[model samples]
Target: MIGETFVLKGNDSNNLIKENVSNLKVYSIDSVRVKHFFTEKVDYIIEGNKLRRTKNSKIPNFDEHVVVYNDDGTFTFNSFPRNPPLTIPFQLYADYDFSDFDSIYGNLDKSFLSEKLKNKIAKREKIKIGVIGTSITAGAHTLEQFYHNSDKDSYPYLIKKAIEKLYRNEVVITNYSQNGSSIDYLGDVFPTALKDNNDLMFIEFGMNDHIYSWWKSNLPNFELTMSNSVDRFKTHGIDVIMVGFFQQNQSWDLEFINSTIEYNQSLSNVSKKYNCYFADVNKEFSKYSQPKINQDFCGDFMHHPTSFGHLLYYKTIIPAFLKEDVNDGFIYNLVN
Candidate 1:
């Protein structure tokens, strides 16, 4: 395999092909294809960890791009000067088989979604799923619009597809999440969020809610807002599921890490009080609390997940949608 690794200076727009190479195939993290077939010279722009593309391109803003290197200095992107730049490492590979990545175990726990709702999906009926919360739900690492169906790999998108595939149903999943959103902010956006009558609603705010400068100092307010959201959505006859947020060891300061753990506990309490399904991905990562393992699953050091991490989120809730066991695998019984 021809492999290239480089550091992308944030906010810089540059051509990746400094010299010339033959038959280049570029891919992003998680072995997601960036350029499947490239015979001509190619270039890229970066902002933070995101890759900037043309207006009509489907590529996302960041995750790390991969490419083959024939440049004089080995694998590297020829970046131009930026007003300010943040140095970020990237990797590119030719004919990568993903043999070196860690194996992902399918472990979906019991779901708390109502039986009636479960039956509807199991029968391949039509359903609408609405998701609200933060950047994670907004397709952070999945890189919305990058590929025609890249977003399908995100948790919400995967949940919809898994239900359809397992139950033979048609599912419509809507994402109303914004980057850097918190519980209180989500509450403020309630009117727009509730405009659609969703069969199932996924709430993800733990990452933002745990921010010390944001919700941690105002813990009571955070709890009240999230509680109100659960009540309001349930009142609207929508089956509510609270997404337990995901984070890694190196993602935050010790203080913020403590707050994140506390916030997840509070989410568990809220789920019990409201009798909702808590898709606790945070708890899943508790086993991987060590920095090495956390980085293995998470794409960024924080909430942005690699494809495997996203799969765990999908597992967190999709099984609950199934009426009976598929009998195809043992991951069906992973209970937390």
Candidate 2:
């Protein structure tokens, strides 16, 4: 039994009177015979198949007690009813569609990279590339989560490996990236990293910049930070490759969208100003509208991408480093 008693309050003119009996008195009524109770102006009406009660003052007041019985063991009151049960089915298709924005943005072409590597081999003693960014460059996922495997899966690792494979010789790659870092923080850090000679360096910083609202509006300051960082590396005879990383979940809120566009535009301006190589991963990742596909590209819903996604990054980034056309190779064929 549902262990509780609900009190009904009202006058007795139309309450508890069996038939049309006026001024009748009744101690209790069977709960099974009645469905619900309601107040009719100054009196209470006991509702069932038909209205049986008429004018009668026999209904008890608030202090009085009455007992009712029902075999069904269900209860009801004038208030709202309880909610029905719910069931949720598991979805296997989730996270199936995530894609690496780097691939989409870089518009990679492998044959072009091969040709560029051949060109570099012909022109230079050794191709030296420097990579600078946040945790992604530090090889967080490749070294930490996927440790036992080959580093060839990570974008940077893959880039380095691809270069080495093409050249069949030592490709010096200095990685100067820290976790939870920003462009402003790189001013001091990059100088030391580029102290050694570097031919190309990839720079990524939008992830940390997006977290700080103040930096978004201060475009001049952000530009200065990038300029200072790049100038330091260039002074050391290093060619700079600027990359703008994309957030997972292709959906960008207004604030992030605006900030990202602004930041990438600023980066592009700087790249052109200095004749530096640049890759726009944010624009590339925007192609996939589905979040599941986007997640597949990214590690979680942010930061880095999965192995396949990293491969896409490799496909996109390698071409830019080599200054090759992005529409003429296995990379172009695969992405299309």
Candidate 3:
């Protein structure tokens, strides 16, 4: 299906679609359900409001990718002929479909995370969390809702919201995040991340860490500085959770992954070194998104997540408070 031609869906029941979405520019950080779309290289014609592919096109088919929407307001694995149903977050003409947003937060090992939450629940104490990271954690590109709290959609704030919602405990957060900065610099802002004797510290500085490739050649273990920061937090009796971010690239054609994932691995090692939680949002993002539009969670077609993206972050996070009796090992993941 790589070189196969296709058509955009209209009133027809089939899922083929290709309209002049030229008017529908897609840097939308505000849409919900049908998550967001990045792009691809292709040519098409809009005839009778149902666009179809020309002689040769590169837009992958439902078989290759999984986001082909049918006219019946239901989408599946795209190639599935109703034997099974599926949903994805690719908004078309505001036909938002959040019916299956939870599918991405696949199975996460919650043992370490749940252990931390048990102490909080048993004591019913107020939770203080410290956040340090790049623009994404600082609420970049995501517009705050009118008549709502500012930066409420950001993960730090959402983390607080999720904790209170699930545990009924008071929560306080100190977010000292700087935009356009990587973990190398942003992780060093001291006194701020150390204030209030934080119960938990969330380190989120991997998106802007493209400097690691050169830093690797010029420096020691690239994550050394971040590991130091985590050590300091741990020294102060602060629990650390190295939050991982998803990358914009989906192709693993080469053995080389992007810097964020590189940092994710580094941070994963750091988490293992300290025995703490490493919330793998990167894996969650990969599970829900299409390859061609891998950066769909990112609003700027880069690294910042939309409000919905932030919500995904929250949902993926809150399961840390898993009930001991809950049989399933995952949160928000559905049986396929």
Candidate 4:
């Protein structure tokens, strides 16, 4: 039995002693009594606490000891330990309907799109758009986790839907994105995929390139990668819309930050060099903080945006695709 005021003591081969004795009134056992108790099964009772065996009764070892806490405001144990505390930052977002954007953009003038470009898009038996990038661009968890429907929630899907509604379902979209891909991978695969002409294609890939060490080492190559991809597609008389993706963790390494800026600058340069449409998705998204919008809008805090986030992307890119002047003032109002 284990109880208040009673302490157990034991020693190793060196005859050293470790005791759990207290000053309070309790039964006392001498060294001989302790030795006899260990040698034989004597029912020693302890008040106010239960006794727990430290080892098998038939093969008990003195080194294996039990821990006992007394009602006298003290605890005795063979092990020494302490608990550590942890703290972390918490972020959340608000919920709002994003479908209103369809109507807003739908009401805009068709003059935004040049007559020649509009005619080419309208003449297509099946209007086509291509998407290329990393995991988020591939629509990972964007549809199932947030939108609940794969076809209705992805940014690419939303863009396709908006195009269909505007053109009365005359559009076809092809998504050729994959997880963990960079500009190098896209440069290799995009040419064959879009050998046939497309009305427009959206390109996003800075997240992977910025974070991976290999991509950081070959940062200068990003410019060539962007130039080749855009030039290859434009050769077929297809229009290109290059997007600069946003990154969530701003406190990441400076190298990553520099690379992201470099890649986005490269994207802008390429878009200009080839006279293609360019959207600064990263800059547009940075306008609103985590408190202003829901976290679901930006999934995994790394890549992918929620439906509302997608709406943000659409709001930013659609105007550019239509050739509308998207200065900071106009974009600021659209996001708010």
**Residue range 33-53, candidate 1, lDDT tens digits:** 434432212344333223334
lDDT of each: 0.57, 0.49, 0.53, 0.50
lDDT of 4 by residue, 198-267 (tens): 6677788777777656765666787787888777776666667777776554432323456667777777
| Of candidates 4 and 2, the better by lDDT | 4
Error of 4 at 65 (Å): 39
The candidate that achieves the highest TM-score relative to the unseen native structure? 1
RMSD of 4: 22.8
As for model 2, its CA RMSD to the true structure in angstroms is 24.6
Model 1: weakest 10-residue lDDT segment is 82-91
TM-scores for all predictions: 0.64, 0.57, 0.61, 0.58
User: lDDT, candidate 2, residue 134?
Assistant: 80
lDDT assessment of candidate 3: 0.53
How far out, in Å, is residue 308 in model 2? 2.0
| True-structure lDDT of candidate 4 | 0.50
**Candidate 4, position 33, lDDT:** 28
